[model samples]
Target: MPVSRRTFLGGGLAAAAVAVTGTPLLAGCASDKKNSAAVNAAVKLPTYQKYGAIKPDLPGNDAVLDAFLKYPANPVKAITDKPGDGQPISFITNIPGAIPPAADNNQFWQAVNERLGSELQISMASNDEYPDKLATRIAGGDLPDIINIPPTTVQIPGLLKAKAMDLTEQLSGDGVLKYPFLANIPTVYWKGCVFNGAIYGVPVPRGMSRTTLPLYRADLLAAKGIKDPAPKNFEEFLALAQEMTAAKENKWAWTKPPLPYIRQMIGLPNQWKEEGGKFTSFYEAEGSSEALEAGRKMVEAGVVNPDTFSAKASARKQWFNGGIASFDIDSFVAWNQYYADNTAGDAFSVNMLDVPGFDGGQGKPWMGSALNNVTAFSKDSKHSVETLLKIANWMAAPFGTEEYLFRKYGLEGRHYTLNGTDPTPTKTGVVETGIGLQYISDSALALYWAGKPDVPQRQHAIQEKIADRLVYDASYGLYSETLSKDGARLTKQMTDLENEIMSGNKPVSDWAPAVKNWLSSGGEKIRGELQQAFTATSGK
Candidate 1:
């Protein structure tokens, strides 16, 4: 979750005041240049009290916003345009749900076309069928001028070999650096877009928070006489879950989707380190037993609904309508929707809990990619390199600004309204506007974007709270396509195995053999590839 300047000041004013006043003498003493530099460095560093609020020194600029607001009125001429009449630059995407016509209207295209003086057209494929279609298209050498690749389906190595065009030279060109927003993209994120020392695509970073955690009905927890409502670790969390389960007067203790997500909540690594610097399936991790044991404890304690394994998405309807479940784990984005839909005049409240780390185990939480997806240009596209650069430059703006924010979100009066200087729901919901609109096609990176000054201040406050409660694993940055392709398959297998074991179709003893098979079947190779990539790229 991201915050605006107002929210940061409002939330931390008391503490900020205390710090500033308490250190008045220190501030006065820092008159020398060296001392002032030290003071500035300290101020730029993140302080726990300001959790989720990016330090003011963190690079944030209005170039993207400026482009959105001023591009049409004063557009830059292309440094070099292709001679003669240009072909319609074909763009392809497989964003989920329907593509709004406004997104592809000539005015929007014109914003891009003006940068290169080329015709632009967009083609969309069904989201579910995109990967296969893209593969076929690429194999047939009939690629679009630009293609949006979903993170889930990108086979990085194969795509690089067949469809991706190296843009290293263009990315490093003087024109690219002249655009401040494009130039400011963090090198950490840019690393993902590079291969074999060459850049191929512009990375669209995802939000920072990734893992789901248990969100509890605070009112219910209080009613159950649960003291110290927040549990610090797995054992204490289990006890609380059991107590809540036993006291179910009108609600179940917990409910969850019948998926591996629950296992993941207990720190089940989808991929894990094996012997000799190789990777192994999650089942092979020393932590696997702890996760499985945790699962078994939940079932035995009856904290989890017996029907949970069979529960469908709608099974939680009772929980949603009647506040039946005391707690459940879900992605952070769902937290906002849950509160919006479930609140009862402030009687009910939601609190995200940090999924406790294992005992004596290193806490390694998953980190989602900053870019939800990547935008790639086809090798044969007619659009000049300058046009693509302009579009990318325009995309770097923070949401909630006069430019990109409204397009990604929506017009404030129409989609939302301010309530006493706070952005709150108008009749339209978050999905109808704001980050919700982007979720249909994008992964809602606006979660990390600054909020509007007038938006309900509570919205930003709650998001910061959620971010504070999240646990992050820096190792998640180690993911690579070389590992991901094999890793995805292994994860699917592990999920299936867990389901089978829980259903009594397989014995727990099967774990040892499964581990052996996983290691031998390309798992070790994937691990080695990831470790090597991480070491080379991250210097870790």
Candidate 2:
């Protein structure tokens, strides 16, 4: 399959293929028999210890995240000792967009190597290419010292057990306390890191910070004499789309079909919904059918851009950012970037749509797994686990620390300059630090927009408002052999069929047989396996 523009994906295929518009469900991956209750019980997770040096402007807790309006003045060092053993560490992570210049040419990379007192080598791949690239590497046994495991990839559990170093002894229970930064990751993110009854990786925690939402340009709407379009139902929502769109003006309600939002408004489950120990894949839900019809109607009405059915994520974002489109459904992570890109003096205030139900009242948001992905140390790694953990701890330093400032800004005067205590990246900084190092390991996710000071406060408030509303993925932290092995293939087939239906190339009736095929092929097995994982983890 070609790299798609789908920004969001639910596990493999849930919340109506939101992956195209937002992000992967951070979706759970494969599992094995080791998913037994006894195994899970014995494998104690890392202890939770929040890392805080500089208090945030809008303080947050476990549910809501801290938001900083400015970079804390004079960041203190998080790690006093060098973390590396001077052994060169090779890492692999997916760069969301452009692959950064290599270490040979990247001054920031060189500086990091200097600071760590070790040669740090990075191999970066685009998100679109990482799956296949990792597959080939895995097949050839040519793995990096630290490898990022994508959520949508299959057989990850088995692979981790076979090739990834088992970190259970090191990270489980109080052991993780040795690396304070790693321990800062919330317990929820680590739960999914367990597979085959062992902990193989450290989760890159994003938590609710990575959810997808329907966003609109409040300023753009205001320009059109529309103060607010807080539609109360699907009817009003559709009407607002039409109201905001004008073909002659090149304005559209959305650049891509807002099917993910529709799916959420229809009250669809994230990926799987469980009741009485029985699981129903979202693919077979009534809400899925409604989302399909609604999406089809949206496409047919011509309220969205002409490229709605096929544009890449970059194009859609350009459309939204340029005000050619007033609305877009994207991951919350995109919020800060969007503000940064809306540089012109033109009015701009990106706002979230209060997504309403199909009839009226509240809409449900399909919250992704707390984890974005996990990074594992390879069995082939020459460095000890403690050393690797130390290395990762250095990388996992929180935003308000000197390590973070240097890692992000680099050779201060050369790569970046301070703008009111915020690290404003120069052109050099942007190019050099673009290697997706964050994918290797990340501190607990937080809200901070350097140049855009007010963004953190506004975004934090928005997060707090919806803290209780998100419908978390029920399949989260569960193991499913079928889901792990066959999820990508089945999800592709399912989403492709959905696209065809929305594009008017296929009939709505086509959904039934396709669903039947999914069920027989692996969906039913996944259902059973998830229930098994759920029961085992619950000690039921």
Candidate 3:
């Protein structure tokens, strides 16, 4: 699991990722399923146009982000003209941290308002509280001009169709080319923004290049004089864990049993496997039994942190920071926290194993769906769709641009200080710019850090190594009523059972019957629904 400025901090990461669609909290609230099903309807999605005003050191490919080892010495404005009328514009979004200083007191917010030539009014809720707020707003028809739709929020494409702008006419195919910055978003990611048969919103993009992985403390390994050979297979990884565990010195090898990583290494399907338009859940896949057995073995090896057996991510991070644990799984986007928090100034290094296959073959690294959320234009607002879109375009200017730099670093001398080319955030900037502003309309997630050039450099190297072997969760952007209604509950059921089996509370053989239970209880229905979506969209 990962936590950071860009990534939501407190949530169930694995289950959320696997769900791909949404949660069940809003099951009691009904909307027209016909609208959600419109995702199956075919239309031209947004086309791709990589921003080239400032070239990146590590160019992006397919799912990889254009990686910048350092910020441009002098950034040019990506958009010169004002995108919107100077009228007040309101946005409702979820925040990863506390609300920033209000517009009256915040210089950063004031500067952004000046740039956009509008009073950018913002309303925020905590990530956990956002769903209820969104649902309430949608039901009451009180949406702001711009609404940030959380990826895991229950899909209400029909409701959105009623309350939000159907952007197909303005954004579909080359229509989005009119907004070059929005066009800069990779094409494949546009599927997430389309709901039913309409482009309901513009996506807030994440990336697969620097995805979630099992990262280890290379500094700790070097301190112990241990060489990192980048494990060839499961066997080698287990051996390395065994060698790294030093219980006598309050150190452990693993933060938790890497079940998902193991399942991926064994060549299991990512959430679902599709063949000839038929879909099968990963629990029923051929190698699932072996993956579970391996997970159990890894847990029983006495190398895992005991605290990690329970859901204690915050506690596990403590162990990692205190050197009580060597390996912890997290996103590369979230990895900067280590260096940012370090006082030792040793540039505490980290590295990953490249996730070798269970049998010493190529391992498939899981690719993220690349959508954080979609920011929709609310019909309730007085602003015109074109006007809102222009404002969004201004907000979404790509990295290395002056607009991007200003939004990110605020006034450099006050909000941030430069460390070489890096605009390191000061305490004021942390309280101001780092607030939930990106939830409005951010450029696709790029690879860059304030002062740590090697961090992104290493991330790019890892992405290149796994480039050919990346496996994406195909369930994303697909219509599934059963999944939308009871997905969180169902995923939690299977995850709980998997944890039980891994912790030895339930025998590994129990997996067979448990999986059978899953199929009869919505899994089959969800599979059928996904199959229909796949067929409708893919024309298989």
Candidate 4:
């Protein structure tokens, strides 16, 4: 339900924290057969066949992404033959931009379909509309061959169990070996796709700690002769924000509430934190109240956009990129996209802020969901399940391969051209590929940028620097019946209350009554169930 440069906005406040973590209720459900993630993981996962087509400039560990300093000069073919069966494959995707030209008139679509050996018809919707549309389509029994299930989907467990193909036998453990590309994906990412103890989909793998970062216009700051862009401590940060504030010039320090970043800076809990086997929600976590108060202070100080709560989501980026605002918070994935879009005459320096602590100590950031989203198949498809599996396999081809090229850039010469191995998209390619193709089934995380060879290294270095200061949710892989059923409503209540406090309409003390209501309204039940799940997984 979140839209930014990409689907995963990463660090949302309380609403996002609870909403993204909720799952479809599967307690004692026939569809899942009572399998837990631990049980599924115990099964033999597919052998991780490393793709050696193009070696990385920076070698990756499980926690890091493969960083490429330059595009492979001689790209190798990963898929030996066309994997798609000569049948039509229908899918639904959440496009972040305008829908591309229809397949009939689009050469890019035609070329991709020709290579896949199937008619890949994509039914597109905006990110905001995807959840409702998916639910409606599933309930109507008009399921597409493939559907992308983001983490934030409502009633995902039930939707997947009732309508999605149970991939336990096909993709569980060694089952995925049948499809070499899918097998190449790391086993850890598959854990996120598991529902009711069975592998249900393939995930777009991402690093655990790479998510939202406090972004600032380093170029703008440098122009003003500010060498040390980031503040040393929380107090200095406030002073710097006020200094950056220029209301009359219509320039401000931020475009949105900075509570999420501030929470990370003060070492606050990420949604849920554990202490002596009990999980504490963000509203009750240590330092959470202070974070809320900090946001209120910024709002009261007139350092951020006054209309931040009411501004359009798209306007946030426009304000930052146009220099109308000098600071904003965005996902780490936006680094390249922001650079590409914002650079015209004066190539600005868009830097990710290393969050500072209250007393100048290194701030701790919360770990992100290990994946962007999952790609699942329908139980009732026009084509055989095997055919769908092969299509997914082809789509999962790693970066620097021919399949990756077709999916990302479309046909060469027409859609894009190689400028010393960096494929520059033509106007046609940009327009046509706007609809999310790579997202349908992307391979493991890669830090490659053809145009900006140094981007991978820069980002990798930053992540490495902050690696130790990352905290994770205690109930990360656990499912709760209460959360599945009442999470949206509960999270929405907290989100509204938090916004009210930030806008100075209410005081931070009001959070206590909200938490009381949340507990009485199933939050207490969620805590107990999640605790049990944690114990089960940890074998404690």
Candidate 5:
């Protein structure tokens, strides 16, 4: 299959041929024998040490990320010397939008090399191409020192055992104290990184506060003398969508059907719901059919954007921002990204639609996995694990430290300029810096908007209101061989059926057969295997 370049804004597909949204259901480093969450949580993890050159304005725990309102005036140093050996280090990671300028010509890269005290190299692939590239590299016996494992990739358990270094001794228990930065990473993130009872990778941590939500144009509705169109139920939501859509005026209610939110409103499981010792995939949930019926009706009524099924994520975001759609589904981070992209003349507050209940009562939002990606090391790395660990520790330096300033923003004059207390990235900085490095290893997850002090508080407030209501997948930390073989086909089949039903090519009656096909094609086995794993982990 030909690969396409793609960027990430959080959830959803990386602009693939088919939209495979939501976080992947399997771990990149997993084991068939058992999941590590339960065992590892009881084992000695790194001591939970905390550090920040500057304290957060809005305090947060592991669930909520610490907030920073300004760049430190004089950032303090965390590492006294370079972490890298005097040799070259090569790694691979996904760069969302642009392939950064080459290291030879890239001043930002050169500066990072200077700070690390070694030549650093990266094989940056677009998100869509990463799985293929990684598999090829592993098969060819030409793996980079560091490999960023994306969740969507398959055959990871065997791959990690065969090729990835085991960091159990180096990172487990109090061993992680040697790398203070790594030690600072929350235990929850590390729990997801364990495989087969051993620590194999470091997580790019994510918070559970908010993952994906149905966002709306509050300003647009206000201008039309409308109240916040947070509907009371799915039925009311459809009416509100119809009320908001004016296709002749180049507006639609939303480009994509808010199926995830719909699932939430109708009280479906996060991904799997368990009852009476049986596990059920969201596809087999009670609300699954109802959500599909509602979706078809909306499509039939022309309330959905015509381009929804085919349009790229970027295009959909543009449509939403331009008032071509009054509501759309997006990652929580888009709240800040959209703000950053908006101009003074086009300023508007992006409001989240409360995940309304089916009966017009309270609703629940799904909490995604505690990580986006995990950074793993090659078992055959030329450098010692200790040396690599040191480099990772330096790279994982806390935000507001000098190491973070350099690694994140690059050289002061070249990559960024100070705007008030904000460290504004230069055009080169924006184009060059964010391409990959910060992802190789990250500091503690923080909520910081340099120039915009209010954003942190606002985001915190939103999270506080929603955190307790979030639901999680019962099979979150477990691995599934059945899912690996059959998930893609089944997911695509169901998604295609949805699009077909919505576009009137198929009727709602088609859903039962489609689901039956999914069940026959290993969905039932996946459910059983996940239940066994869940039982093993929960001791239920």
Candidate 6:
């Protein structure tokens, strides 16, 4: 369950203060390791004395609201004639599809360049390769003026040490706050952008996407005479899977991917700590053990196909074509892509199921974090504060506004026509009228929950239902460099172990020593570092 912000802060404040100020405190603490308790007691005294109550400054802005109401024209001038005369500002984005067409370059770039009063250039890279490329560029002292760092790779320690330009002061200031769209962002997300009390990035608000719910074939459930097919607990869920399999009369109960279902099973976030300072894999969490056991039981019972994990996209194809009965899928896939793929008729009727809670374990239901992505400025950018501010303002603007939609979707009549109120494309007019790949980073373009008529309203409905049912994993912070590099490796190892055990190739008895080894080898260190960091910054 989600803890209140106040409760989280109250519990963690001291540890957080220590982590944030630990560099100076480390010297003192280092000398008294022999008397650690005494040192801890001594440290508390000074922390309490020096650190007074720190309240977050919540600034209000009527001007920003006005600007939101009336979005002003682009303030910068076009650099069409002398393309390279002005300060050339480069924007590095992970959205592989965001790049505008070369033919429309003169029109689009001219508009962008004019809006920024700078020679604007846009570049695209794949999300998978972005972190490595970004790291190399930053390390080599080569950086674009505006660089986007997905929350997944925004390593707090590395970014701070690298001297990334701090935008916290600017963003919080009166000038930037005056842009109304900026206020639309939730303050909870600001935590990811804050490192050591300094902000280095302008958060690009991403709406809820990629969250998973039980995407089951409702028609199959009804045919099986199962009412209230949605399971509320792990046991019930497993039973439902069994029932569905039996009702299939030979068809598989569920499709499977290589991805483990434990994270969803126990409502635990993707990461957690066990014994040592090293970060243990989520699979190593107590909840995951229960989840694994559940899976083992299901497999042993023949509720799930032994070949389920080997099933691919073709499995989903078969399921939609009436081969398999039910499976788990993201709400978006079940509604938008699946339905659209079978335009001849409804391939399957679907419904969302609330992720089941563990019976004896944690009561939390697994859900995705609210944040989707973030945008940051390069540490070496020479652009003035005013220019950067303007860029940020432009970024915060909503879709369907003059700035983003017109550039992204093109002129409505000429490029595409609204098939109906729905945002997702339905007809060739909107389909052929290219929107490019702007959806990569643009939240407004990806309408996950907010509804439109022509599009799959079921997807939106399912998302909202899931949101209402599950709590966000507030314990897990955005992924940092240290976490990602280490966590990725650990996750892979753990997943391998799981595969071995689940396939009956290895026994669950091996889990203890394997866990000990994991912790002894750097898992504990990572955990301590993260716990320490979380405590220090969270003001708990």
Each candidate: RMSD: 14.3, 5.4, 4.8, 4.6, 6.0, 9.8
What candidate 1 gets wrong by more than 4 Å, as runs, is 1-91, 94-130, 136-142, 173-176, 222-228, 246-250, 257-270, 273-281, 310-322, 337-348, 357-364, 420-485, 531-540
lDDT (10s digit) by residue, model 2, range 11-81: 22211111221222223323445655347546677898887567888888656778888899989887899
Tens-place lDDT digits, model 6, residues 1-540: 234432221211111111221122111222112212122222111011111111111211210011111112341221123222368777766643233354244344455566546666666566556656665665566777776655444234345436467665565534334444454444444444544345545554322444555566766777779755656666777777777775346676766531344456566544443232234456456665666666666676676655665665556556644646476555443454555444335435666665555664333434444344445666667876556655565554554345455444444454434444212333433333332223223323233211223233444444544544443333344222234335445545667777676666777776667777777765665566555544443422
List runs of model 2 lying over 4 Å from the truth.
1-32, 35-38, 343-346
| Candidate 5: tens digits of C-alpha lDDT, residues 193-230 | 66656777877766443477787877777877776566
Q: What is the lDDT of candidate 1?
A: 0.46
> What's the lDDT for all of these models?
0.46, 0.75, 0.74, 0.72, 0.71, 0.47
Ten residues in sequence with the least summed lDDT for candidate 1: 11-20
Best by lDDT: 2
Which candidate, 2 or 3, would have the higher lDDT against the true structure?
2
Q: How well does candidate 3 match the true structure in TM-score terms?
A: 0.90
Q: Number of clashes in model 2?
A: 13
Ranking by TM-score: 2, 4, 3, 5, 6, 1
Candidate 4 wrong stretches, greater than 4 Å: 1-43, 208-210, 343-346
Give the true-structure RMSD of model 4. Answer: 4.6
The digit string of per-residue lDDT tens for model 1 on 1-540 reads: 222222111111011111111121111221123211122112211111111212221222211011111112222222243221355666666644344444343233344445334554556666666766665676567777777755554344345535667666666444346444455444444444543335657665444333455667767777767633655566776777767775345545778432233344455543333234344445675556556555665666666666777776456644643566777776545554565565465566556554444453323344333455567777776666666666555545433333343444344575545444234454443433321112112212333212222112322433443444332322233434333345456656766777566555676677778877877876666556546643443322
Q: TM-score of every model? A: 0.66, 0.91, 0.90, 0.91, 0.89, 0.67
Q: Residue 387 error for model 3, in Å?
A: 2.0
